[model samples]
Target: MMRIFLMATLGTLTAFAPPAHAQQAGETRLVVRPSPAVPATPTPDQQAAVLERFARARDNLVALREGRRSVSDLSPQELQDVLDYDRRVRGDYPDTRGAKQQCIDDEFRRAGGRPSALARQVIALKCRN
Candidate 1:
């Protein structure tokens, strides 16, 4: 009777142990789907549109960083402008990489102040509020 009880307890404990295939220390299981084919190339009009969009997104980011606009304060036009800018910049603006960050730094410098902890806090609060 004692041996039977010990065997049953060990069996139950082993049964509840995590499965070996569940996950491994350095292995990640990712589901991959085939991405749709991209167009051969963007046309001239598409290029121009992309440039314009980048400029607009840069402007929006600047405004947001400088406390000129809030997340909730954007109008439909502003939202569309920012979205268009994002798509264009991501698709086009290789020359103006980090343009928004540069603009923010330039504006901060031009305003006769450096970006401080307080300024970042203010921007964060303004963005959230």
Candidate 2:
């Protein structure tokens, strides 16, 4: 008896309820699918291309640091507005290749030939290779 009452009440409530806009007007709602959160991995060829580009950028950085090359010599097509990128890279790594080696040697001497965790992290950040 209770089950029947519940069923009847449910039916009455549903019957009296106003129809949803789409259902009432017989209109179809368009749904737009969202893009994937994670981007697709690069192909081998794409990876190689990126590596080569970075290698070129590294060479450019070295040349610019040593005063052997000018910003105008950088290929705009290969690295767009490369001067800014070079500046940022230089800012992050203030030391040149020789300076970095000297820094590492000094750090080792300062640590008394036993590098601590902080020293290791410093070396890693200051030295590229």
Candidate 3:
């Protein structure tokens, strides 16, 4: 009895739902579908691509710290911006790469050397021999 009452109440609620503009406009109803499942592991090519990108970004960060690169397109903005902000908010700019690395090393230490899955992969591939 309780189940039937709940089903009836649900049916009534659905039946009285505000009409969609699509229905009023006489357009085809949109079909909802789940996306395909992604593979648990990246392909070799995908891994290589990520490593390549990481190398590029790391080089860019180094260059930015050294004033050897343009700041217009800092791919990993946090690499420089966070350190810049921390200093500016409390101190000033013209900080060294050692300062930036210090910030990152501190953060990496805070994570107990356990980076995110992506970071872990990068560290294993790039940071490690």
Candidate 4:
């Protein structure tokens, strides 16, 4: 038992340690372990607040995207496709980080334009937590 405890302790320590590597010029790294999350159920008020904020952010993002898209450029079907995708994402992944936003931004660039407002909101939503 004592031997097993020591091995486990050593293994955990190593897991928390930085890599042993030669530093490059101006190389820097920061490592942090966040506190373990306590999954407490949200109160009614808390849930309401979260929903309100999410709605505001989502509306703002969609509005920005609509503002940027000229009605003539994107066909009605394409516009509906984008909006439906947006809705599905929101419903399917309410707590999800904006992992798809990078793809969105990349496509936006390939098509030639700045990051859309919706893209920015995606990043912002992830940061809110």
Model 1 compared with the native: what TM-score? 0.29
lDDT of 3 at 38: 80
Residues 1-129, candidate 2: write the lDDT tens digits: 999999999999989887766366667778899977897799999999987877777777778879999877767764553554576776864555586788788878877988999888887687655
lDDT tens string, model 1, 20-128? 8875688777999999998679889999997886677788877987999886887787787776666665685545636556655555675477667887665445444
Candidate 2 global lDDT: 0.76
- Report lDDT per candidate: 0.73, 0.76, 0.67, 0.65
**Worst 10-residue lDDT window, candidate 3:** 120-129
Tell me how many residue pairs clash in candidate 2: 0
TM-score, one value per model: 0.29, 0.38, 0.30, 0.25
| lDDT (tens digit, per residue) of candidate 3 on 28-97 | 7678999999868988999998677666656666777788877666545545554555554567767566
The 10-residue segment with the lowest total lDDT in model 4: 92-101
Off by over 4 Å in 1: 1-38, 75-129
Q: How many residue pairs collide in each prediction? A: 1, 0, 0, 0
Ranking by lDDT: 2, 1, 3, 4
Please name the candidate that would achieve the greatest lDDT relative to the true structure: 2
Q: Candidate 1, 114: how far from true, in Å?
A: 38
Q: By the TM-score metric, which is better: model 2 or model 4? A: 2
How would you encode candidate 4's per-residue C-alpha lDDT over 2-115 as one tens digit per residue? 999999999999888867573356777688989999999999999998677566545644765779545466556555555656777768544443646665555566646665
